[model samples]
Every structure is written in C-alpha cells, then in structure tokens.
Target: MTYCLGLLLNDGLVMASDSRTNAGVDHISTFSKMRVWEKPGERIIVLLSSGNLAITQAVASQLDDQIRLPGGEKRKKGSTLLTVPGMHAAAKLVGEAVRKVYDNDAGSLQQHGADFIASFILGGQVKGGPMRLFLIYAAGNFIEAGPLTPFFQIGETKYGKPILDRVIAPDTPLPEAVKCALVSMDSTMRSNLSVGLPIDVLVAKTDAHRVFHRRSIGEDDPYMMGLRKQWGDGVRRLFSQLIDPRLDE
Candidate 1:
C-alpha cells in the first residue's frame, strides 16, 4: 500500500508519494515510488506508482530501458518516453508499458490467487507543449487531468482526498498546491499504517521543461511536524465552532 498524488495547477505540476510497502505486519519495507526522467531544458517526465510493487517496478523498468536506448533505436522499436511528441503520447507510452507488464505476469499472479493491481500518475512538460497530467491504469488505459479534475491520486487515496477536493484549482499557486499535497499525504499517514515516512515530492513550473523543486521529507522534518500540528489544531477548532444539530427541538 502507498499514497501518491499529483496536482495540475496553472503555474505547473506537483507530485508526491509515500515510501512504504506492507505485505503483512512483519513484512514492511520502504521503497520510493517516484520515477523521473529529465532532458534539462528539453523535457521533464515524472511517474508516481502504487499497487503491486513488483508490477509497478517492472513497468517503470520497461520505460527506463526504452528511454536509455538510442534515439533511432527507440523510434524503430517503439515509443520511448523521450520520443513522445506530446504529453498525451507520453501517457499512451506509459499505458502500453503497463499492458506489457500485465501480459507477462498477470496470469501467473492469478494462478496464486493474487490480483494484478497497479496504477500510475504521470505528469510533466515536453518542450514546445503545455504541461499535462494523466492517470494510467492497469489495463493500458488513461485519462488526462483537465479543468474540472485537475489532479489524480492512487493507493490509499480516500484518507487524503478531502483536502485536495476543497483546496486545489487550476489557478492555485504552485507553492500552495505543493503544500496541499503534503497536507494530503500527512492525513493519509496519520490514518493509515501502510503509508509511511520519507515522502518524495517533485514540483515543476509551467513551461520550465524541468523540475523546479525536489525533496525527501523524513519523519523528523521540522516543517512537516509543524504543519501537521497546525492543521490538526485548526481542524479541531473549526469543528468545535460549528453549531450542533437539535433533533429534540
């Protein structure tokens, strides 16, 4: 289990993922679920994955291998992340990668009574194009984030979705959006044991074609601790101020 989120704001994109994977009480581990590919001034692509860890890792490996191939080889063989002309094409490339992995391992997992479960959030900018964000599923299908729905989430999403729903919009500032993402992740971590510490966050400014900020937030980060405390207190105060229902009257 994990918690990964991506926000598409007018200023740019913000992505975040928790680093915990738990098979059982005793079989827990930390693995960063964020993958990034950048061509400096040319393009920047970020992937946030959740679900069966093995399947997600395999999909990411497939994309990485394709990215490392020579340009002509990549084009001749298939579409690599770098070869995609736009964000939509890049999303299709990711979807195909997910399907390829499912074809290879889904049946074997099914035989053992395990399901082939995986999902991804892909967001970034390609030179000459506007920044875009996508939510790719296990079946080689995806949808882009738009004005009505300017964000996506995978894994333990329910615990953190309320804040995002109330705060995010197309015109939200990048910094505020990133803060919202962290607050979202923090909410998940507090309510769920499966989503743990050392979160990875990446932010990209619109048309920058590169990552503007990246950070690994650990358990002891002062800023995170303060934010959590403040948010919790604020929520409690707000709840207390609300009028109670009077059924008897």
Candidate 2:
C-alpha cells in the first residue's frame, strides 16, 4: 500500500507520495514512488504511482524508454511525454503506458492468483497549455481534475482524503496547498503502517513550465515534525470543544 496525492489549484499544482513498500511485515523496504521529467522552459511532468510496485515501475520505464528511442521509432510509437502537444496528450501517453504494462504482465500475475492492480496521478504543464492533473487507472482510462474536483489520490487514499476534501479548492494558494498535502500525508502515516515516511513533494506554478519547489521529506525533518505535532494537537483540542450529542434525545 501507498499514499499518493495531487492538488490542482489556481496558482499551480501540489503532488506528494510516500515511499514504503512491503511484501510482508518482515520484508519492508523504501522505494520512491515519484517520477519527474522536466524540460525547463518547455514542460515539466510529475508522476505519482501506487499499487503493485513492479507494475508501476514498469509503466514508468515504458515512458522513459519511449522517449529515448530514435526519432523514427519514436514517431512510430506516437508522442512521448516530452513531445506531447499538451497536458491532455501527456495524460494519454501515460494511460497507454499503463495499458501496455497490463497487457504484458497481467496474465502472468493472474495465473499466480494476483490481480493486475495499479493507478497513477499525472500532473504537469506543457508549453502552450494550461496546467492539468489526471488520475489514470489500471484500465488505461483517466479523469481530469477540474474546478469542482481539484484534487486526486491514487493509493491508500482513504486515510488522507478528508483533509483534502475540507481544505483543497481550485483557488487555494500553492503554499497552503503544499502544507495541506503534508498534513494529509502525516495523517495517513499515523494511521497506517503501509504508508510511510521519506515523502516526495513537488510544487509547480501555473504557466511556469518548471517545478517551483521539490523536496524529499525524511522522518526527522523539522518542519514535518512541527506540522505533525501541531495538527494532532489542534485536532484533539477541536474534538474536545465540540458539544457532546444528547444521548437521551
């Protein structure tokens, strides 16, 4: 299990993902779930993945490999993320990568009684295009984020969704959105062992076509520690101040 989230606000986008992967309690390890491709002034793409580690990695590899192919081969394969015309086209490439991975591995995994499970959160901006965010599922289908729904989560999502639901909006400031993402990630880490530390966070300003801020937050990061403590205490205090329900009524 993992927890990956992306927020699309008017100012820009915020993306975050945890780094823990485990086959069992005894076999736990850390693997970053964030993949980034940047072309400076041209385009910047960030991918957050969750689900079967192997499948996610394979999908990411497909995208990378496609871009490295020679010109003729690349064109035969269609547009790669870097050459895609817009964010929407970039999303289509991601979906195609997911389906390609499924086609190659799903049968073998199912034969072993395992399901082909994977999902991704793709967020970025291409030159001449508005910033966009998408949630790509196992079947290669996807949905774009919009004003009404300005955020998306791809894995172990329930633990971190409430804060986003209450705090995120299309107009939320980029800095505030980053803080909310961290708080949401902390909430999940506290409640679930499968989703954990060493979170990767990326922030991009609209039309910048470059990552504005990026960080790898470890277990001892000072800001994260303070935010965790403050948020927990504030929540407890708020809960205590709430009026108790009238049982007799």
Query: Per-model C-alpha lDDT, please?
Result: 0.92, 0.91
Error of 1 at 239 (Å): 1.5
Model 2, 142-228: lDDT tens digits are 999999999999888888889899999998998899999999999899999988989999999888999899999998999999999
Could you estimate the TM-score for every candidate?
0.95, 0.95
How well does model 1 score by local distance difference test?
0.92
Screening candidate 2 with a backbone cut-off below 3 angstroms (N, C-alpha, C), the clashing residue pairs are none
Model 2 spans > 4 angstroms off = 70-78, 245-249
* Deviation (Å) of 49 in candidate 2: 0.5
Give the per-residue lDDT of model 1 (tens digit) for 1-249: 899999998999999999999888899999999999898888999999999999999999999888675664636543778768788888998999999999999999999999999999999999989999999999989988999999999999999999999999999998899889999999999999989999999999998898899999998999899999999999999999999998995
